[model samples]
Target: MSDSEQPGPPEPDDSDPPGAEPSSRRGRRPEPIGDGVGAAHRTWLEPVRSRLVASGLTLDELVGRSGYSKTRLSELLRGKGYYPSWEITYSVVRALDLPPWPLRRLWTAAAREAAKKQGWIENRIQAVQPLGLEQPPVAHQAFTLAMRAPYAAYARAFLQAEDRAQRVVRETFDILWLTWDEACATADVKRHAWQMLRSRVMARTLQQDGHPDLRQAAFFTAAQAAIIDLAERSAHINKMAGFFDAVARLPQDQMDVIVLTHLCTIDAAAVPGIVGLSPAMTHTLDHHARGALNDLYRQHTWE
Candidate 1:
């Protein structure tokens, strides 16, 4: 199609009577057209209109930005008509970048309507853009922790048969509950305790001669500080049983190695001595432990 061949949009025909419907009454506003229309729409659109205008958008600009016809947009803004489908609402919400209070309210309202007829699918359906709905001054904590749950679950299963399984369970809950005790101070204390424990343990072990990187990563090394900060903010689940059922089923020896090397972040070599694993079996244990931890640690920081 040539550029000129594109059809020009038609102007709104005001002469066409609005044709009042059964919903009309004396002093009553015209019904906003939609499926499952809510009262809020009657109240919100004129405000949306004023906001769009205040933000330097002309009526045509608002219409173009919203991907709605000028007539439809005007109808919405006039409180004479509106259709609050997620598609239309999303367009308006995105163009304006609605404030946090209004933004969350929109999703909450949409989600409630979506809930009765659907489950998780509807949850996603109701979710608006900028999916990180966690309000500012606090990073999006809920979704972040939700993302970690799978990793937590997987590692819990992977490390089954290890005694540190309890620690895994504990770490999961600890990560979840850090915010409950006041985020900053409690996190600082936890970080400090782990840090001192790692530094002291490493200082003594290096005197015995071992790899330093292993020592650093094995303990409260700087590499994992972000992990600590996030764990501090986490609030997933606590006071729940079956935390480290994985480690419980595993041999006590394997569990000790994971505790010493992973959570304690001590030298990896220390694990064999601590867990009492034979030199040959140490290789098998290391392979399994690394696999288990890869997911667990990755979850702590996934974007």
Candidate 2:
């Protein structure tokens, strides 16, 4: 099927935490989010909830500070109904006196997972109207530029959205900029920066049966190959799905090596640099990933 024709994952319901006070209670605790797409909600909301409790501001006080209604603030805190837009989220973030950068990154990821339109995300962000992050230091500029395309390539493969992937890459670089002095002092800054990028992408990536969802990625592969016919593309996607399921079952390091090498088409030699592994360790992971896939294929085929 074509990219537009593919169905989105079902939205999970928001539930209150166990034994928590009712939503109307003054001291009610925030809800806990489980795995899967909920991770997107959890990442941003958990921090906000923590800060809200820390601030000891009643809902009424928060409403006054954020200039939003108590009902809206309650819904956002509870992760109910629709995902909150960046503008409102930022208002709450500011009300709690929380730093904007980290929350913004997490909020963007959740927005993408909610399938918010790119234009909508952009307009909401623009409505906030704030100063941007500082430019990367001169020393970090060359390294950041060189890695942008490859980092974005890996991010795009997992995220399935150009705007989301680019935003993630920008956030990763922003983080690297903030810690450039420490990163520069590390034994391998390329490896350090890559890990930072990988963590951000994986945080936003969808999950299937506890593994990163590779099935969604198959759609992009089919598109890039120009497999325009619906029947042919469907067959191709199914075949790739099985392969990627096997790929996802490998050890995390091996899986990263395999996806970086095969899916993103990064060179074998270059992968060690990006993944922050020694050349020998990268080869070992590549070998094990292939062997594991073979074993899985044999077991599945035999069954």
Candidate 3:
């Protein structure tokens, strides 16, 4: 056959052969897609879709009744997207005039299964297990570990009072005892516990100091005084009191960033994970904190 007349390789087939896996454009096995939640979501919604079809409900009717776009309703019925939010699911159930109980059960199961598969729950359990907190002997071991954790310093600096910090840590462990299952199911269990303690300490300190607003409180002076008292009582005290005092005066968000980054020596990237701020927000807070610290030093003539 002449070059021009030569037959091209067989046209690519769009359909896969029976029992064959799907291939991607690069001819590799298609990457597993979706967060597995969508599969459970789809499975759960299948019966609801069947019910809608059997009732002769049209997309137009569903859209009008549920106030969802046709595309959204189609996606929900076809299970083409992430698990639908509760609002979407409930709206559809109401629109279909179906008993909400059955669908609600399925939806809840799907959501829970998806959460488990994502490791959000399992990772938390693992985090606690390593600390031996999940067992009944949690009292002695967990309490000792929590008391000695480096993050404890961050809490003390945040509260500006050793007594208050100790109280907060104790209460945090009590809470962990009460909510052991929940703690084990949470993502970043240690961070969650630390945040809980920080919040409690902040609240108590604010109340006792009558600061009304943490952002406006003169925490620097208070922190310096607290650190000075510690320095007087303990031979182990260091000059870092001045630095922590400056950290104390920062706005709450900025203060949190400094404590997590400097005192805890956490990575800048992981600071956000501990403090529950976005990376951008954490960076902004860190910048503002450093600037504020410099301004404080200049004002105090601390060379």
Candidate achieving the largest lDDT: 2
TM-score head-to-head 2 vs 3, winner = 2
> Candidate 2's residue-wise lDDT over 27-128, tens digit each?
555555433437567656766787677667777677788887666777788787677878779989788766577667667777887887666667678889
lDDT of 3 by residue, 85-129 (tens): 556677887786654544454565566655434343333233321
What is the lDDT, from 0 to 100, of the residue 25 in candidate 2?
40
* Residue 53 displacement in candidate 1 (angstroms): 2.9
Angstrom error of the Cα, residue 210, model 1: value is 81
The lowest-lDDT stretch of 10 consecutive residues in candidate 2 is 8-17
How many residue pairs clash per model? 10, 0, 0
Q: Model 3: how far is 6 from its true place, Å? A: 99
Ranking by TM-score: 2, 3, 1
Model 1, span 79-191: residue lDDT tens = 44323345555577667765434433444443444332234324434554555644532332442343233323323333432343333333333332322223344534333
Better of 1 and 3 by TM-score: 3
lDDT of 2: 0.74
After superposition, candidate 2 runs with Cα above 4 Å error: 1-135, 185-187, 222-232, 298-303
Question: How does residue 20 of candidate 2 score in lDDT?
Answer: 48
In angstroms, how far off is 181's CA in candidate 1? Answer: 32
Candidate 3 global lDDT? 0.55
Clashing pairs in 2: none
Best by TM-score: 2
